[model samples]
Target: MDGSFENAAGQARARVALRWRRIGFSALVLGSCAALLGLMAATLFVEAPDPVGIAMLLLFALTLPWTTIGFWNAVIGFSLMTFCRDPAGLVAPHLRSIGGTEKIASSTALLICIRNEDTGRLQRNLGWMLEGLVASGESRWFHLYMLSDSNQAPIIEDEQRVAAELSARFGSALSITYRRREESSGFKAGNIRDFCERWGSLHQFAIVLDADSVMTPAAMLRLVRIMQVQPHIGILQTLVTGLPSASPFARIFQFGMRLGMRSYTLGAASWQGDCGPYWGHNAILRIAPFTEHCHLPVLPGKPPLGGHVLSHDQLEAVLMRRAGYEVRVLPEENGSWEENPPSLPEFIRRDLRWCQGNMQYFHFLSLPRLLPVSRCQLGLAIAMYLGAPAWLGLMTLGLLRQMPIRADLGALLFILTMVMSFAPKFATLADVLARSPLRQAYGGTARILVSAFLEMLFSMLIAPISAVAVTLFMLGLPFGREMGWSTQQRDAEGIPFALAARRLWLQTVLGFVFAVCFWRVVPGAVWLWAPFVLGLAGAIPLAMASADPRVGRALAAVGLCRIPEEARLPAEPEYATLFAPCAPLSPTGATE
Candidate 1:
C-alpha cells in the first residue's frame, strides 16, 4: 500500500512540475513578444503610421514571437547547462552510468537505413562501428541490419556488395543481414515500417542509423542500458554532433551547431519530458510499441501539402506518447555523430526538403488526443521555417517604410536580437575556456575566440541568403511544387558559377536592388546592412569559396574553425584501419 502511494505521489508531482514549466515557458515567450512588438509600435506611432508602416508593424509582430521563442529557448538552455540540473530531474531520473557490459542484456537491432548514399564511406563506417562494439565487448547484445531503399541498379548492387563483404569479414562475430526494397513508397518512414512489419517481433529495441551516422559502441551500449532500466520510455535520442569535416562551410556551420546544440538540446530535453524529440537517425526506439502504436496514417490532403507525412520523426514520438509511452533525449550524452552537407546549395536543398516536411505538420497539429507539448513542437517546427519568410517580409517592409529611422534604436534592437539568438555560443565558448581540457581540445582560448568571431560573421553573411531561399521555397509549396527527395551530397566541391546563379539569381537581384536603393537613399545606413547586402550580392562567389576543400584545408591547418573531434580522433582501432581498401562486391553478393 505504501509503495503504491509513493508511485501515485510521484505521478502527481510530475504533473505539477510539467504544469509549472509550461506556464513559465508560455509566459516568457508571450512577454518577450509583447515587449518587442510594443517597442516597434511605439516607434511607428512616433513616426506617424502610414499603411506601409502599419504593415511593417503587423509583420514585426508576427515575426517577434519566432525570435522570442528562440531567445527563451537559448536562455533557458544556457541556464540548464550552467546550473547542471536536469529539467526532468524531479519527474524522471536519468540512467547515466552502467555497472558492466553484462548489465546491457536486452537484444537490440542496430538498423542502418540507406538510399543512394555513399556506399564506400558507409561500408567503412559500418565496419568501424561493428569493430567498436566488439572492442567494447558488447557485440553479442546487438544485431546488425543494413536496410536499403535504393531504386537505382548500380547503387543497389554496390550496397549489396558492401553488405556481403562486411558479412564475409565479420559474419562469425556478428549477426549481419542485408535487405533491399523495390518499392520505397513512403521514403524513410515507410522503409522503417516495412522492417517493423517483417521483423518487429525479433528484437526488443531498434537503434536507427542514417547512412552517415556513426555512434561509438560504448554510447550504443549505454543507450540500450537506459532503455532496459526505464521500461516506460519508448525512444531515447542522443544529441548527435557533426563529424570532422574538410569543407570550410561544413566546419563553420557544424562548429557553431555543435556548440549551441549541447546547451539548447539540454534545455529542450528537460522541458520535453515524455514528449522528447526523435531526430530520424542516431536514436533508439522501443520496437513493439513503435511497431504497434507508431504506424503513420496518410493525411487527408493532396501532394506537397498533404499525402504521406514527410516529417515523420516528431509525429512518431507524439503517437508513441499517445499510447502511454515516454520519449526522452539526453542532450549532454556524446558519441553520436553524423556528417553535414558540404556546400551552401546542398545545405539549402536539404533545408528545402525539411521545410516542406515541417510545413506539412500544420495538418497534424489539429489531430485529436495529441499532447499539448506535442502540438507545441509541431507549431514550433512550422514557425521555424515560416520565420525566414516573415523576416524577409519584415525587411522589405522596413525598406519601404522610408522614414529616417533612428540608427541608435535600430542598432540597439539589432544587438538585442543578435544577443538573444547567439548568447549560447558565447556561453559555450566561456564554458570551454573555463575548463583546461575543453580549452585544449579546441586549440586553446585564443583559437576558439577567433573561430567564434569568424563563424558569427560568416553565419550573418549567410542569413539573408538562406532567408530568401527558404522564403521562395515555402511560397512555392502551396502551388503544388514538390521537393523531390534525393541522396544528400556530402562532398566539398565548388558549385558551378552558372548553376549557382540560376539557383540564387532571385536572391542576387534582390541584393543588387537593395544595395542600389540603400546606397542612393541611405548611404549612412549602408554599414548597418552591408553584411546582408554584400553576402547576397556575392552569393555565387561566397558559395564557391565556402565549399572549396582547399579553403577548408587551409583553415584547418591554421587551427581555425577547429572542433574537438578534429583535433583528437576517436580512440577506436577502426579509425586506424579506415584507409585500407576493400574489393568491390559483385552482383551475386561476392567480393569481385
Candidate 2:
C-alpha cells in the first residue's frame, strides 16, 4: 500500500511536468505565430490599409500556424538530432528500457488491414515479416490477422488464397487467420471494429499494418516490449518512412518526406509527448482500450463530410487519450516503411482524400472530454488543409487588388516565409551531412546534395499543384464531391499524357491565367509568383513526366533521389529481394 502511494505520487509529479512542458510549447508556438502575423499585417497595411488588404491578411493569418509550427518543430528537431545522443529515448522514455531481449509476455495480433490489394506483393511482405518473427523465437506471442474489406469476388478469392498459402507455409510455427467482411460498413475503421468484436479480447495489443506497410521483426519486437512495460501508452506510432521506389515522383517526394519527417516528428514528439499522432497504419494499439473507447461516432449527416469518420486515426488517438492513456510516437526511423503514391495524379488523389477527411474534424472541435492538446491537434489537422485555400485566396486577392508598394519588406517576408516552409527538410539535410555514417548511408555528400537540390525543385512544383487541387476539392465538398474508400494503385506505372491532361486541365488553365495576369499587372513581381504559376501552368506535363517509366529509369540509373535503402542491401534478406528490381544498375548493366 505504501509502495502504491509512492508510485502514484511519482506519476502525479510526471503529469505535472508534462503539463508544464505542453504549456511552454504552446506559448512558444502561439508567440511565434503572433509575431509572424504582426509582421504580415504590417507588411500589408503599412502602405494603404484597405479592405482587400485586410482580407489578404486574414487569409495570410490562416496560413501562419501551419508554417510556424513546422518551422519551430524543425528547429527543435535539428537541435536534438545534432546535440543529443538518444533523442528518441529522451522523447519516448519507455523505449529506453527496451533492450531487444525482453521476454514477450503479452499476446499481440498483427492486424494487416486490406481492401482489394495486390495479392502477390501482400504475400511476399507478410511472408518476410512472419519469417523474421519466427526467427526471433517469439512467434508464439504474435498472431497474424488478415482483416479484409475487399468486396470484389476476384479480389476476395485472391486474398483467401494468399492467406491460405501463408497459413500452410507457417504451419504450427505461427498462427494466421483470414476474415473478410461482405459489406465494408465503416470502411477501414469498421473493419478494425469487426476485428475488435471478434478477436480483440484475446490479445493485449494489436500492431496495425496497412496493405502497403512493412515492418522488420526487430521493430515489431521493440513496439511490443515498449507496450509491455509502458502499460499507460494506448497507441505507439512508429516513424514510418517510404520504401525505395522506382517511380521518379515517389523517389523525389519521399526523399523530401524522409528528410522532413525525421526532424518534424522528433520536434513534435518533444512537445506533444503522450498526445502524439496516430497515422492509421504502422502503429501499435492496446486492443482493450482501443476497442472500448475508440469506436468512432458516425457524424449527423450524409456523404462527404458526414457518415463515418474517414480519418479515424486522429480521432482514435484523442479518444484513447481521453481514456487516460498515452498516445505516443517513437520518432526513430527504425525498420518500418510504407509505399508512397507513384505519380502526381495518384498523390493528389490520396492527398485530397485526406483533405476531405481532415475537414470533417470541424464537427468535433467542441467534443466533450477531449484534452486541450487533443483539440489543438484536431484544429491543426483542419488548418493543414485550410492553408491551401487560404493561400489561393491570398493569391486571388493579390491579383484582384493589384496593390503595389514596399518591395523591401515584401521580399524579406517572402524569403523568411520560404525559409520557414523548407526548414524541416533543410534541418535534416544539415544533420545528415554533418554525420559521416549518415552521409555514407545516403550515398555520400555529392549524391545527397544533388538529391536535395532536385527534391527542393520537386517540392516547389508539387506544392502549388497540390494546393490548387485541394482548394478546388474543398470548394466542391458542399456539392458532394466525395472521395469514397477505394483500393489504391500501389504499384508504379506510367500515367498516360491523355489521362494526365484530362485530370489536370483545370490546373493547367488556371496556372496560365494566373501567370498572364501577374505578368500584365506586376511584370517585375512575376519572379515572386514564378513557382506557383509555373507549377500550375505545367501541371499536365509535370504529371506525365513524373510518371513516365523512362524518367524513373533515368533517375534510378544515375542514382538521383536515391534513398538509403537503395544504396546498400538491407540486413533483412527479404528487403533485399523486395528492393532488388528497383536497384540502380552498375555501368556494366549489372545490379550494383
List the candidate 2 regions with Cα displacement exceeding 4 Å. 1-10, 570-574, 586-592
Q: Write the residue-wise lDDT of candidate 2 on 451-502 in tens digits.
A: 9999998888878899988998999999999998888987778788899999
Please give, for residues 76-168, the per-residue lDDT of candidate 1 as tens digits. Answer: 776755665554342236555345354777889999989898898898799889988877766887889888888888988999899889888
The global Cα lDDT (0 to 1) of model 1 is 0.79
TM-score of each: 0.93, 0.97
Clashes of each: 0, 0
TM-score (C-alpha, index-matched) for candidate 1? 0.93
Candidate 1, residue 479: the lDDT equals 93
**Model 1: runs farther than 4 Å from truth?**
1-4, 85-92, 97-102, 403-407, 570-592
Deviation in angstroms for 278 in model 2?
Answer: 0.4
lDDT of each: 0.79, 0.89
